[model samples]
Target: MSQRSIKITMSAVLLAAATLASTAPAGAAHGGEPLTDVRVATHFDLAAGQMPENITLLPDGTAAVTFAAGRQVALVSPGGGTRILATLPAPADGGVHTPVLGFPLTTGIARTPDGTVYVLYATGTADLTGLWRLRPGQDPQRIAALPADGLPNGLALDAHGRTLYITDSVLGTVWTVPTTGGTPTAWSTASELAPTGFLGANGAKVRGGALWVTNLDRGTLLRIPIRSGNRAGAPQVKASGMAGIDDFAFTGRGNEVLAALNAPNTVVRIRPDGTSTTVLDAADGLQNPTSVALRGKDVYVLSAAYTTAADPNLLRAHLRGHR
Candidate 1:
């Protein structure tokens, strides 16, 4: 990957890592030619009624899907599909109570390099519900929480996994927290960035010298230079052509951002210069796809419904209402 592409995708450092690690050069991850079609590499079918809010791949390559309806996080395997794991109850530690700012309406998820899983839920009692660290044989512990109305939308980690990036939709800001012990501190405030304000801070990634964030209400993607933990100066929008944009991933060599649009059940591949092409029209294997998770060349999409061919209503609806 080229320096600019790496900087664009993960942050410039990741670009350096890629170049030092490989000799593919600039035009590698970027499509060598104009791209066409939304490729369906694999489809792992799950239960029809179970909706997945967020997804993360385990160390063993197993995929974990967070459920919106139950106390169980579904452990999905190739053949087993989904095995319910009881949501470990929060334990009391000393007199130091980890505030349950938002529990149970779990949305954000991240993992350390060692496979420790951190899941955030809306704590029913306060602004934050629960922050749980799930380690094998270790009872889940509530480490941190966010405000009740403060929705934690995106989660990302550094190369070493010590630092975590989180987005606060209600506050329209981003935070950097230590994976070990610490109250999440402000990393960047939206007001300092030009365009002045953010609609809703949704998804985030600290990869390759840039910090990539998703602004849901604004239907845009943003980038900021990474220096230590500070976002410092203003951030720039990488792309702004989707409606109801929620989450995005750096896939296909880091030049493309695949965004899952909520309304028309669509996913679009956007370029670095803000141009976009609808890879999956609402009629193509999508139905209110809330999130898109990438694992290598495959993509796991969470949707409220399914999209099908022989459908004018689905595709036309997106043409009129979305990007």
Candidate 2:
């Protein structure tokens, strides 16, 4: 890979480090040419050098973004006003806390229909890695702890709000934990999930009675059927060669997904038939797009721009051929 590709990969790894460490929305989606008419809804203070990683939509149409290096989560209003929601602690200094790849990364954040917020942060120390729950006017609660060597990234919860699925990017493992509080157990350990580079299993979402995941190093998207008893059945490749794939959201179209390709700085509309078309790309002002989320008819993208002098940005744009 070229130097630019290397930088993008590093940024993705660091951002992924956060999700592997926390871990969008719906709309009528269509595939077409790249979307160039993008608008920036918010931009962080360039001097802060904050890297905004993954994003989850709030029930009221606002957004919450994770700042990996900053160790905090912020709420961004629909009109772009931002306020800090919570500040996370650094690792407790036990196993290993290194920042050669990235430091203080907050990987993923999710919100349920009931307005409860869940966040994953890389404590760097083994036992310090935590998945936390933040309720209204309450201190964050530690729900569960992941493995020392594992980087817990993407997150998904069942409809009944009883079970939660977390993806480990470094170890390429999927873990299961009870929302009511319990130990996290391995849900799936298929060989296909083995890490090929800096990351393995990353973003995840529950749809169509299964859990969908993307592998960063291998650039493959896989689905593991969720059996009747919440057991993960055999795995299947949904799409491949989607290099640098990070997080994605389902479109209104059957089995179609809007995927964020981090290294290439683009978002693609992957069809049910496993084909993909660019919806927005580098030329469309995407500078390392890390996450995408939808609220009603609007689609929002979070671009980290890790290599740029400008601060990270969140852009709002229309999905080509969707409106």
Candidate 3:
């Protein structure tokens, strides 16, 4: 769905600024405990339509990000350099047929060690909505065809990188496709993945033989085990009460995670027990934070400024007490 849609849905539950101030303690005023050194690493040109939607980090500290509204993928370096990689061609009708959001958008992204980048595009048209693969120097190619009626939102590669799993927010399904590209399989259609009104199954990741996903409208984190013979076990809701959560990254500390709460303009650290704490908020320059990534001790956050419509940028923070 659109940012305006999210803002309207989240307005009632937005954490008040006064509540945040009252919760501040000695050393964690701006950023809550276990998060520090928060700062903007790069300020994207919002006027140029450079709002980042999802991110994947390379080994060299560079980030491959999908510009949701721009229908483009670009790389951002640690030192704040930016480079446009490729722009997906617009549909003949200019995405007028696009689903819920009413426009074509690039969503989740995942990169392999060999530099093969796979990203998702949703134009609500059969000819252009699906998963696209981009080799080092080749133009982006549609590898798999997804349903035009569904909103393909999140993308992830499995443990061996042999399979790609996708989340369709509108359809409330999880689709699996081979890395080489082919027809997608509706791997799971759990009711938990259904959207309340806006969107569902927003962000996804595969780890520990299970696929982890977030439902934006339901405000819940779900895990579906990858059982033997490539079957999907029953889904389990791991966490809830986080409205507007867009995307998340595992903290490498067991099941701990850092998740971006989009309309709330906050990033939170969720513990294994399902409890969450506000790690970074608007005070740290978060403007509709879309995704979170972790590279060693650094925490990378992409703010699309979708609702705020100002300061679309990337912020980095230090993860304290991270062993």
RMSD of 2: 6.0
lDDT of 3 by residue, 262-305 (tens): 87677888888988888888988999898999987789999988
TM-score of the candidate numbered 2?
Answer: 0.86
RMSD of 1: 13.0
* TM-scores of all candidate predictions against the true structure: 0.70, 0.86, 0.91
Q: Name the 10 consecutive residues with the lowest summed lDDT in model 3.
A: 18-27
Cα lDDT, all candidates: 0.54, 0.73, 0.85
**Which 10 residues in a row give candidate 1 its minimum summed lDDT?**
309-318
Off by over 4 Å in 1: 1-49, 88-104, 127-130, 192-199, 229-231, 305-323
lDDT of 1 by residue, 198-252 (tens): 2366777776677788765566788867875355446887876454566766665
Error of 3 at 310 (Å): 0.6
Q: After superposition, how far is residue 295 of candidate 1 from its true place, in Å?
A: 2.5
Find the candidate with the highest TM-score and give its number: 3
Residue 126 displacement (Å), model 1: 2.8
